[model samples]
Target: MSEPVLELTGLTKTYKPGTPGAVQVLRGADLSIAPGQVVALVAPSGAGKSTLLHIAGLLDLADQGRVTICGQDMTGKSDRIRTAVRRRDVGFVYQFHHLLPEFSAAENILLPQLANGVGRSAAQARAMKLLDRVGIANRADHRPAALSGGEQQRVAFCRALANAPRLLLADEPTGNLDPDTSDQVFAAMMELVAGTGLSALIATHNLELAARMDRVLRLENGRLTEITGQQAGAGFLQSD
Candidate 1:
């Protein structure tokens, strides 16, 4: 089997450690996402789903554990190395679009490539290609405020993929949209991810969406449990 694009072992996080109101988000949680695999992480609001994603994405730290990205052990690494790894290997999408209101969709996508040292012309071309793949090419020149909810989310998807990262960490990518729009947007996002052979770990409360992925893992009591398609439920996100 191919190596996992992202791996977490013995991950533990505690907020306000040793305090009276300390909350334990993760307790030795372990997960591995194989290359080109799409895994769904289902958890309730307070079940530490966001905390897990943040740690996995290198946006936050774990009190104890290892974070390996594409074969490199990033845990306790220098800030510079961790930043480099995150820039080169991971893309992220959150529940909110968070696109720059003043920038066009294409520009929003292009800026990240530019920051990564891609030339302007090359960045523009790549942005256009991603927009086309997401079926939002026509809206490329529009600003976030001018686009519909679905279109805005599609733009965010393109932006996340702009750098061509090998791993994608999406937290409720379609959560903010209506049911119909969320379904359509998710289909487009999946097509885009598959086309690039990217490994994805997506977190969503929607059981139907979770079942569509290659595997489903539910978080409870600061641990992960493998769950089957039929086992998914609206109440599965509860914390232990």
Candidate 2:
């Protein structure tokens, strides 16, 4: 078997470490994502789901744990190395679109590639290809403000994938949209992921959406566990 695309081992995080009021968010949490797999992370608010993604994406550090991406161990790496790893191997998406209001959708995607040292012509072509994959190529010329909520989110998806990262980390990616739009946008994002053959770890409260992934994980008190149908049903009710 090939190595997994991403792995987290014994991850632990405390917000106020060494302080009297320190709150431990993760208690040796562990998870892994294989190539072409979509794993859904389901956890209640304040359950430290965001923290896990940040650490996995190298946006933040874990107090005690190891993070490996594409078979490379990233724990204790310098900020420069971490940044390079993040830029070259990881892509992140949050609940909000967070697109640049002034830049067109195509430009928003192209800029990151440029920053990664890709040529302008190749970056432009890649951006349009991703836009077309998401069924939003026509809106590529429009700025975020000009697009509908779903369209904007689709563009955001394109931007996140601009560099062809090996791993994708997303937190409540479709949380801001209406039910119909959310489903549509989520489906489009899945299509893009499938087409690219990348591994994705998406945090979502929507059970229906979670069920669509290859596996479901629950993060509670900082430990991660694979959840079954019964647990998923209970979590659905609890989150609702």
Candidate 3:
């Protein structure tokens, strides 16, 4: 079998450790994502789902744990090495679409590929392809400020995948939109993920959207618990 695309073991994180107002967020959290599998991470607010994603994506270090990506151990690695791995193998999306207001949709996507050493023409082609996948090809030349909320988020998704990362880590990719828009944007994101065959771990509060993924896992007490599709709708309730 192919190796997992991402792995986390014994992950633990705390805020203001040893202080009077200290908060322990993660408690030996463990997770693994296989290649081409889309996993939904369901959790309540402040359950440390973002923290876990930060650690897995190499954006933040865990107080104690190991992160393995594409078979390489990231624990104790140098910052330079971690950054290289992150830029080359991982993509991230958050609740808000943080696109550059001045750049066009295609430019936003092309920027990352250009940074990764892709040729200009090649990057532009890939950008168009991604935008097309998300049904936003015609909006490629529009800036973020000129697009609707759904369109902006679709651009962000394309940017995330521009580098062809092996793993995608998203936190509430469609949280800011209304239900109808969220569903539409999410379908586009899933289509992109499926077409690329990359592993994704998406954290979301919407269980209906979560259930559409391959598997659902709830984050409770700073740990992850695999849950059934039937149990997905009740994830937030059970996490409380």
Candidate 4:
């Protein structure tokens, strides 16, 4: 069998350790995502969804536990190695589009590939293709200010795919849009990821969206538990 795209065992994170206000964000949190799987992470505010994504994406270090990505163990690795691996293997999307307002959409999408030493022409071609895939190719030359919220987010999605990452992490990716626009953006994102056979872990508050994923897991008490589709709907009631 193919190896899982990501695995976390006994992962834990604590803030202000040994101080009065120290709080534990993750306590023995564990998760795994296989290639081509789309998993939804549901949680209430302050349940550490972002914290967990940060650690999984290699942006933050966990205080304890093990993380393995694409069959490679990450524990005890140097910061430089971790950064390199993250750059080459993981893609991230956040609640905000986070595109640079000054640069054109295509330029923003090409930046990461250029940083990774890909040739300029090659990166531009890839960025344009991704923009086209996300249905925003016409907006490639427009800056963020010239685009609508949904268009900017479509650009962001194209940017995230620039590196062709094996794993994708999204934090409330559709949070700011209206329901109809959110559904469109979500469908486009999922269709693109599915076509590439990439695994994704999405953090979201939308129960309807979460239920449609391959699996749904809820974050509570700093740990993750699989939820049935019926249970997912029930959980959202308490979340609100």
Error of 3 at 134 (Å): 0.8
lDDT of 3: 0.92
Q: Model 1: runs farther than 4 Å from truth?
A: 233-240
Off by over 4 Å in 4: 233-240
- Candidate 3 colliding pairs: none
State the lDDT of candidate 1 residue by residue for 1-240, as single tens digits. 898899999999999999999999899999999999999998767889999999999999999999999999987798899899899899999999999999999999999999999999999999999999988899889999999999999999888999999999999999899999999999999999899999999999777787888999988889988887555555543323
Model 3 misplaced stretches (Cα beyond 4 Å): 233-240
Please give each candidate's TM-score.
0.96, 0.96, 0.97, 0.96
For all candidates in order, the CA lDDT equals: 0.91, 0.92, 0.92, 0.90
Superior candidate under lDDT, 1 versus 4? 1
Ranking of models by lDDT: 3, 2, 1, 4
lDDT, model 2, position 146: 93
Instruction: State the lDDT at 19 in candidate 1.
Output: 94
